[model samples]
Target: MKAAVVGLGVEGIKATKALLDYGWKVYATDLQTEIDLEELKISISDAKISTYDEKINISTNNLTIDLGYLDECEIDSSDAIVISPSLCNTKIAKKALSSGKLLSDILDKHKEIFTIGITGTNGKTTTSLILKEILENAGKKILIGGNAGGGFEGYYDLILKAEKGNYDIIIIEVCDMTLEFCDYAFNFDLVGLTNIGNDHIDVHGSIENYKNSLLNFSKNKTTFIDKNQIYLKEFKESNQINELVEYDESNYDLKLFGKFNRLNAGLATAIAKVLDVEDFIIKNTLGNFEPVEGRLKEFKLNDSKIYIGKTDNSDAVKSILNEKYFYATFIGTPRSNEEHRFEILDTVASHNPEIIVLFPGLEDTVEFGLYRLKSIGYEGRIEIANNLDEIISLLAEYSHEDAIFIGGNGQKNIIEIQDRLELLTKNCN
Candidate 1:
C-alpha cells in the first residue's frame, strides 16, 4: 500500500515513522525547509517493527520511502491522504481528498477501543490533560494525540498507531477544524464539550456554525457537557440520539485560577464518574495535576503576584478579566489574531486595570494594537514597553503589591516571560 503524508512537522514525522513501521510506501513532504531531514532519516532507519503490513517487499528498508521538503510534491495516487488541519481548504488538499479517503477514515476500526474526545473553543487542552490524569490514576495507559495550542499530529499518525491496538484509552483534543476535515471518523466512548464562546470566527464564519460543529461531531457518542453552558439549550433542541451527560460546578484543590478551570475539572470528573473511577483518586489527581502552562499561571517574586495568560480571541481576553482582579496588566494583541481590539480594551477598561501594552515578537502588531486602542476613545493609563526587558522594568515600578495580568495573543513559550518577570521582582525591588 502507498500513503502520502503532508506537512512534516512533529506529527508529520511521527506519521512517517509509523508508516515505515507498517512497511508502507510512504511519501512525506513539508514545505518547511528548516526541518532536519538527516536526523529524521537516522530515526526511521533505527525503528523495529513488530506489526507488519500485508504487502510485498515488507523487508525493504528506509530507502524505499522518502521524507523531505515539498518541492512540487503532489499526491498522485496514494491509498489515503492524511492532512494537517490547517491545510484542509488548500487546493492541494482538495486534490488529495478527491484522490483517496482520509487516513482517519481508515482508523475507524479502532472505534471499538475506549476513547474520549474533548472539544471546545478553549479549555480543551486542560480538560484533556485532566482526563488523562484521572485515567492514568486508575491504572490506564493513555495515548494523547491532538492539538493543544496547535495541532501537532495529523490523522495519519493516529490512524497508523491505532492499528497497533495497544493503548488502553485514546484521549484526544478535537477542534472544529479537525472535524471539518474528517467528519464522524472517531466514535468516542466519552465526549466532553468545554464551554464555547466567540472563537475561531475566521474559520467557521459565525458563532452558530462553531456551536453546531461541536454538536455535529458528537453524533452516536456519549458526550459530557456543562449544563450551565449557553450552548446546552441549543444542543438539547436537536433531539440527538447521543447520550448527553450534564456536569455541574464542583471544586477541588486545583493549582489554577479562573472559574473556567473549575468547570474544566468538573467535566473531567463527569467522565471519571462515568468510567467508575473512585472519588478519592479523582481528587488526588486534580490536586496534583499542574495547570497547562501559559494558561493562567501565577509566579511569586517576594511581595508581587505575577499572573500570566494567553487569550487568542476577544471572549477569552474578556474571560481573563472577568476571572480575577488585576491592578495592572500587560496586554499584547497580535496583529493576526483577534481583530476586535476595541472590544478587548472595553473589557480591560471595565475592570479598571492599569494597561501596559507589552511587545509581541513583531513590533508592527503592537503599533497596530495601540492604534486601535486609541481609536476606541479608551482614555486611560496606557503604558508601552518596547521589549521584554523594558516590560520587566515597568513591572518592577508598578509592582506595589498589586495583582498583575499579562495576556494577549501570546505564543506557547510564555513561561519565559513569567520567569523574567519573577527575576525582576527579585532584583529590581
Candidate 2:
C-alpha cells in the first residue's frame, strides 16, 4: 500500500506515522521549504509517542518527502491521499477526491469500533466534550478526537489509537471543512447534529452547501438532531437517514449558561442515553462541567465577572446578551462577510452595553467593524485597544464592579487576555 500525505502539520504528521505503522509506502509533501521541513523532522524525532514505547523515527526505506508547491508532488502515484484539515479544499484534495483516494477511506477499516460523530456550526465542541465527560463518568473507555478544540488530538491520531484497541468508543467533532471531504467515509455508529447556522460560508461557498455537506455526511447513520431544528425536518424527509432521533432540552441542571448550551447538553444527553449511560451520571457530569475554554469561559476578579469566548454571529451574541446583563462588551474584528459582521455589530449595539471595546484583529476587518458599529447607531463608548496589554489595562480599569463580555473571532487572543488577567490578579493578591 502507498499513501500521499499533504501538508505536514499536526494532522499530516500523525497520518504519516500511522501509515508507516501500517507498513505502507508514504510520500509526504508540504508547502513549507526544506528548512522548515528539517525543523519539523527534528521536532518529530525528538518527540515521543505517548501511546507507544518508542520515539517517532520515520523509517527512510519506504518514506519519501517533497517540499515546495503541492503541485510538484507525485500525489497521483500514491494509492491514497491523506490531507491536512487546513488544506482539505485545495486543488490537490479535489484531485484526490475525484480519484477516490481520500484518507477518510480508511474509516471502513475500523468498523468494529463504535464511533460517534458530532457536528454543528456551533456547540459541537461543547456537545462532544459533554458526551466525553458523561461516558467517562460512566466508566466507558473512549477516545475523543477531531476538532473538539483545546488542542485535542485529531482524527488521524484517533485512528492510530483505535487500531491499538485501547478504546471502546470514539467521539469525533466533525467540522464543516472535514465533512466537505470526508463525506460518507465516516461510518459512525451514531452521529449528533447540534444545530446548523450561518457559518463557514466562505469555506462551503453557501449556507445551503454547508448544510448539505452535514446532511450528506449523516446519511444512512443513526443521527440525533435537536427537535427545535425545524429546518432539518424538510431535509430529513428527503435524506435517507437510518434513524433520526429528535432531542429537546430536558432542562438538565447545568453550570453552563445560555439556551444554546442547554440544547447542546440535551443532544449530548440523548446520545448518552442511546449508549446506555445512566441518567444520574449524565446529570452529574453536566452539572459539574464548566464551559469549554473558548466557549463563554467565565472569570472573576474582585467583584467583577468576565465572560470570554467566540461570539462571531448575531445569534451567539444575542444568546449571551439575553442570558445575563453585561455592563460592557468587547468585540474583535469580524471574520465573516460584511453583512454578517454588520448583523453581529447591530445585535451588540441593540444590547446597549456601557462600553464597546474593539480589540485588535485583522487590520482590514478592524476598520470595517468600527464603521459598522457606528453606522448601526451605537452611541455608547467605543474603545479601541491596540494590543493585549491595552486590553488588560482596559479590563482592569472598567471591570471593577460589574460584569463584562469579551467576544470576537480571535479565540486565541481572548484566551491570552484571560491568562494575563488571571496572572495580574494573582500577583496583586
Candidate 3:
C-alpha cells in the first residue's frame, strides 16, 4: 500500500508514522522547504508504542518526503491521500476527494469507541471542559481533545488513543474545518452543540452555508442542542437526526460568569445525564468548575477585576455586556472579514462602555474596527494600542475601582496579554 500525505503539520507527521507502522510506503509533501526529516525520525524513534516497536524497525527506503504541493503525478502514483484539516479546501484535497482516496477511510478503525463530539460557534470549549470534569468525577476515563486548543490532543491523537483502547470515552471538540472534510466519516455516540452564530464566514462562504455544513455534519447523530437557539426549528425540520435533545439553561450553581456560560453548563449537564452520571457528581462539578482559561478567565489586580479571553463573537460580547458594565473594554481585531468586524463593533457600541480600546490581533483589522466604531456613533472614548506595550500602559491608567474587560475572537496575542496581566497582578500583590 502507498499513501501521499499532504501538509506536514503535527497531524500529518503523526499520520505518516502511523501509516509507516502499518507497512505502507508513505510520500509526504509540504509547502515549506525546511522540514527536518532526521529530527522527525529521532522524535518518533523515542515514541513509546506498546505494540508497534517491531513495525517501527522497518526500512526508511519506502519513505519519500518532498517540499511542495502534492502534484497530479504524486496523486496518480499513490493509493491514498492524507490531508491536514487546515488544507481540506486546497486543490489537492479536492482532487483526492474526486478520486475517492481520502485517508479518512482509516476512521473506520475508531467506530467502536464511544465518542462525544462538541461543537458550536462559541462556548464549545467551556462546555467540553465542563463535561470533562463531570465525566472524570464519575470515574470515566476520557481523552479530551480536538480544537479545544491550548495543548490538548487533536483528532488524529484521539484516533490513535482509541485504536489502543486507551480511553473509556473520547470527547472531541469538533470545528468547522474538521467537519468540512470529515463529516459523515464517523457517527458520534452523542454530540453537544453549544449554539451557532455568525462566524467563520471566510471559511464557509456565508452564514447559510456554514449552518448547512453544521446541519449536514450533525445529521444521523444523537445531538444535544440549546432549546433557545434561533436555528432550533431548522434542526427540527431537517429531519436528519437520530435523536435531538433540547438542553435548557442550567440553574446549577456555577463558578463561571455570564448567562451564556450557564447555557454551556446546561448542555454539559444534559449530556452527563444521558451518560448516567450521578446528580451529585454533576452538581459538584458544576459548582467547582473554574472558568476555562482564555474563555473569560478572570484575574484580580488590587481593587480592579480583569477578564481576559474569548470576546470574539457577538453572543460572547452580549453575555459579558449583560452581566455588568465595564469601565473600559479592549477588543482585538476579529479574525473575520471587514464586514464581520463592523458587526462586532456594533455589538460593542450597543453596550456603550465608558471607553473602547482597539488592540492588534492576528490580522491588521484594528484600524478598520476603529473606523467602524466611530461610524456606528459610539459615544464612548476610543483609543488604539498599536502593540502589547501600549495596551499594558493603558491598563495602568485605570483606577483600582474600575473593572476591565479585554478579548477578541481567537486572537493569537491572548496568551501574551494574559501573561502580562498575570505579571501586573503579581506586582500589585
Candidate 4:
C-alpha cells in the first residue's frame, strides 16, 4: 500500500517512517523543504520514503495534500492518506472527506480503534502519560503516541503492528487543530477532555470554536471531562454521547498539587474506572506520576525554588495559585486576553512577591504578558532576562528565599536549563 504523509512537523515525519517501516511507499511533503527532518530521526537514504518541497508539483497519479492550504497535487489513486496532527487545516479535512480517499485522521482513527483520545488546552500530556502508565501497569499491551503522546509515528500502522503483539488498548493525545482531520471516527472506548482555558485562539479563533472542536473530537465516546469553568455542565446535557462521565475534581487522589492537575487526575481516574482498572492502581499511579517535563517541573536552587511550564500563551500563568513568601516569574508571551495576564500580575503583586521576573518571548506573543504586568500597578522589580540561563542566574542573586517560575513556550529551552542546573547542583555537592 502507498501512503502520503502531510506536513513536515514531528507527527508528519513520524507517520512517514511508520509507513515506510510497514513496507508502504511513502511520499512526504512540506511547504518548507528545509524543515529539520533530521531532528525527527528521518533517514534520507531510506528508499521507501521520499521528501519533497511543497512546490515540487508531483504527478496526479498518487498524491495527497499533507500541507494545509498548499494542496495543489491530486490524491486520486493513493490507497490511503494519513493526516496526523496537522489535521488542523479545515481545507485539508474538507478535501479528505470529499475525496473519498481511505482517510485516516489520527484523531478519527483513535476514535475508531479501541483508543483513548485525550484533548484540551493544557494538561492533556500529563493526563495521557498517567493514563498510559495506568493501562501498562494493568498488563495491557498498549501503543501510546500523538501530540505529547510520543513514540510510535503512524497511528494505523502502529495499530496494525500491535496486532502481532498482544496489546489491546491504545492511548493518544489529540490537539484541537487536528480534531477536524478525524475521518471515520474510531470512537474511543474512553476519552478525556482536560480543562478548557483561554488558549490557542491563533488556531481555533474563538473559545466557542475551541470547545466545539473538542466536542467534535470526542464524538460518540465514553468521555471523561475535567470540571472546567467554561465547559462546566457542558457534557451533562450532551446526548450525543451516552457514556459520558462527569469526573469530580475532589476525586483526584494524586500528589500533583495544582487545581488543574487535580482535574487531570480526576479525569484519568474516571477513564481508568471505565477500563475496570482497580482504584488502588489508579491512586498509586496518580501519586507516582510526576508533572511532565517543562510543566510545573520543580528545580531547587541552593536556596531558591524554580517551577517551569509550557507558556505559549499567558493564560497558563493563571494556573499558578497565589501563595505568600514566594516570588513568581512570568515567562513567555502573552495572549489575546490581556485580562488574564494582568490578573496574574495583580495576583503576584497582591501576594507582594519578593520578585516578578518576566521573560517576554522572542515574538509578539510576549507583549500581552509583560505589558500587562507593568500596567497592573506593579513597579517593584521586573527584569527581562535574555534567556533561561540568565534568568536563573538573576534569580539566584535576587531574594534567595523566593520561588521562581519559568513559564511559557520558552520551555523548549529547559533541556539547556536542566544541563545548567545539573552543573550547579554538582558544584554545590
Candidate 5:
C-alpha cells in the first residue's frame, strides 16, 4: 500500500503530496540529499511524506518512499509510480518503468475528472486562457494546469488541486517535451493542436519527428486541429486518427493580432462547441478577450498604434506584419535560435518595412541577426538603439504615419518597453 513519486523537481514535489492524500504511504525521491524535508510537509495535507536521496548520506525513516532512486533501491516494487513529464528520458525513468506503468498511463484512475489537452509551438497560453473563460461562462467548474499552461505551480501540483477540488473538467496545455516523458499516455474527451510552427528542432530530432510525437500524444483522442496549420495534412496522413476536425477560421472580431490568432480562436471555439458552450458566450469571450502580455499585446498613441510580439522566430514575427500600413518594426535578438533568426530576418526583409529599429539584446546573436538584415539588402533605414528606452523614443517619433511593431526574443525586458508606450499614450491624451 505504498507509492513513490519520482524526480523531486517541480512536478515531483506535487506528486509526493498527492500520493500521500491518496492514502498511500508516500516517499519523495530527490537527487539532492541536503534538501529540507520538514519544510515541504505543510499542515494542510495531513500526511507525513518523507524525503530520500541515496547518493548523499541523509537519515530518514521513510525508506519505502524516500531514497528510492539510489542503487539497490526497491522503487520497482512499489504498486504505482507517478512521474513528471520532464523525467521521461532519464536513467531514473528507465528504472521506474522497469516494473510499472507511467503516471500518464494511469490517468483513467481519476474517471470523474474529464480532461481537455492542448498542444502547439505557439499560442498555447493564449488559447488556454480563452478556453478557461469560455468554460467559466458556461458555468462549468473548470481547472487548468500543465507546463507553464497558466499556473505557477507544476503540472503535478495543478493536477492534485483539480482532484482535491473535484472539478468537472480540467484543461491541460500539453507539449511534445512534456508528453514524451510519459510515452504520450492518456486519452482525453477533447484535444487540440493549435499549429505546428518552426521550433523545437533539437528535441524531436526534426519537424517530422516532432509532428509524429504530437500525433502520438493525440492517439485515440478526438483532436480539434487548425485547418490552416501547415502540418495538419501531413499529421492526418501519418496517423489513422479518424475523428479529426479541421477548424476553419471564421471572421470573428478577435482582439489579438494576425489571422493566425483568429485561427487559434477557431480551434478553441470548436472545443467549446463540443463542450456545449453557447454561441453567444463564445462570441462574447472573443470580443472581450485580451491578448496575453508579450504575445501580440497591443499599444496605442495619438493617431498611431504598435503591436508587440515577443520573439524573433519567423512564425512569431511574420504573423504580426500587415501589408497595408507602412511598418516601423523594432527587431534584434540573441541568436538563440540561429536558424530561425535568419529565417525571421529574411521574412522581415521581404516585407520591406518602412523603418527597422534594432533593439539591443544581451546576446552575441543580436549582432549576427542585424548583420543578416543588412545582408538581405534592406534598403530602408535600420537604426540601432543602445538601450530599450532609445527604441521606445524612436517608436514614438515614427509611429505617426506608419504602424509600429516590436519583435524580438527578449520578453523579460518588454515590460519596460510597454510601460514607455503607455506613458506616451497618456501624455498624448
Candidate 6:
C-alpha cells in the first residue's frame, strides 16, 4: 500500500513513521532545505521507520529525509494520504479533500468504530489523556491520538494492531488543525468541547473563524459541554445542537485536580458512560492518573520550595488561583493583531502576589507583559533568567522563601527542569 504523509512538523514526522510501520510504500516529503532535514532524519531514524516501496528505499537505519518542492512531489498515485500537522493549512486541506484520495485525516483512523472526539482551545490535551487513562483502566482497549498534545505519535500502529478485533473504545483529541481536513462524514460516539477561548488567531485570522471551526467539530456527535461559560456562545445557537449533554461534578467523581481539570473530568466521565466503562474503574483511574509532566506538574527543592510548570497556555495559569505566591513564566507573545498580552499580566497583578518573575525568551513577547506590568506601578521583585539552568538555579536559590515558582516563559525544557529539581531535592533531603 502506497501512502503519502504531508508536512514535516512534529505530528507529520510521527504520522510518516506510523505509515511506514503499517507496511506501506511511504512517500514522506517536506518543504525544508538540506540543513532543516537533519533533525527530522534523526527523529525518523530513531523511530526505526521502514518503507516498503522498492523505488523509495528509505529505512530508519539509513535516515536521509528527501526534500522536494510540494508542487513536484508525486502524491496522486499513493493509495492513501495522511494529513497531519500540515493539514492546518486550508489550501492543503482543500487540495487533499478535492483530490478524492482515501485520506486518513488523522493518525488514529476512526472508520466504523466507537470513536470519541474532543476539541476546544486549552484543556483538550489534559481531558483527552485523562479520558484515555480512564477507558484503558476499565479494560477497554483504547486508541487515543489527534493533536490532543500527549505525544501520541504511533497511534496508527496501535489501531492496526487492534484491527485483529481487540479494542472496543477509541478516544481522539481532535484539534482545529485535525478538523480542518477531517471529512465530517465520520461522527463520534462522544464529542467533547472543553471550553472556547481566543487562540490560534494567527492561523484562523479572526475569533469567529476559530470558534466556528470548533463548533463544526462537535456537530451531531454526543456533545459534552462542561459549561456554557464561553464568550463565543453568542455565535452559537442552543437549539442547533441535537443531543447536547452538559456534564458537571454532580455527575461523577473526577480525580484530576484544579478547577480546569475538574471540568475535563466531567467530559471524560460523560464519554466513559457512553462507552459503558464501570463507575468503579473510572473512579479508580482518576485517583491514580497523575497530571502529565510540564503541565502544572509540581517539583520540590531541598529548601522546601515548590515549582509548578504552567507553560502551555496563559489560561492554564488560572489553575493556580488559590495559591498565594506564584512566580509565573510565559513564552512566545501573541502575534501583533492576534492576542492580548495585558490580559494575563493584569490577572497576575490582580492576585497581588509576593513576587512576579517574567522570563519571556523571545524578547518581544516579554516586552508586552513587562510594559503592562510597569504601567500598573507594581513594585514587586521582577527578575529575568536568561537560560533554563539560570532559571532553575534562580528558583532554587531565591524561591526558598515560601513562594511557588510558576515556570512558563521560554521554559521549553520544562519537563526536564521539573524532573531535575525533584531529583536534586530528594538527594539533598
RMSD of each: 6.6, 6.1, 6.4, 4.9, 5.7, 5.3
Clashing pairs in 1: none
lDDT of 1 at 161: 71
Query: lDDT per residue, candidate 5, 189-231, as tens digits?
Result: 7778887777656667777888888887777778888776777
Best-performing candidate as measured by TM-score: 3
Tens-digit per-residue lDDT, 1-429, candidate 6: 677766666666665666556665666666553323342445543654343322222345423344544432557766666556445455765677677663444333456678777777767777888888887787777776765134555334434544445567667766655675443534477778887664555677776787777666656655777655564354346455557777775244543446677778777888788778898888877777787766666555644456465444445555555544555433333323434434556566666765676654324456666677789877776665555676667666654565564644333456666777777777766
Q: Which pairs of residues collide in model 3?
A: 312-409
Worst 10 residues of 5 by lDDT: 56-65
| lDDT tens readout by residue for model 3, 304-376 | 7888886666766777878888888888886435466447778878888888998877576787887888787
Computed on alpha carbons, the lDDT of every model, listed in order, comes to 0.69, 0.75, 0.76, 0.61, 0.68, 0.60
Query: Per-residue CA lDDT of candidate 2, range 1-429, in tens?
Result: 888888887667767766777788887777664323442343455433232232222335667665544444468877877888777667777777788777666444555678898887778888899999999999999788785233465677566567667677888888767885444445587889987776556667877877777777877789898887856676568558889899998587988877888999999999999988999999899989988876777777767888888876676788789987788888877653545544777888898998988876433366677888887778989888879988888888876757988886677777787778668777764
Write down the lDDT that model 4 would get: 0.61
Compared with the true structure, the alpha-carbon lDDT of candidate 2 equals 0.75
Worst 10 residues of 2 by lDDT: 48-57
Question: Of the candidates numbered 1 and 2, which has the greater TM-score value?
Answer: 2
Strongest candidate by lDDT: 3
My TM-score estimates for the predictions, one after another, are 0.81, 0.82, 0.83, 0.79, 0.77, 0.80
- After superposition, which runs of candidate 2 have C-alpha atoms over 4 Å from their true positions? 1-3, 7-26, 30-68, 71-73, 76-80, 85-102, 106-108, 148-150, 335-343, 362-364, 424-429
102-137 per-residue lDDT for model 1 (tens digits): 676655655666888888877888888899999999
lDDT of 6 at 261: 74
lDDT of 1 at 66: 33
Global CA lDDT of candidate 5, please?
0.68
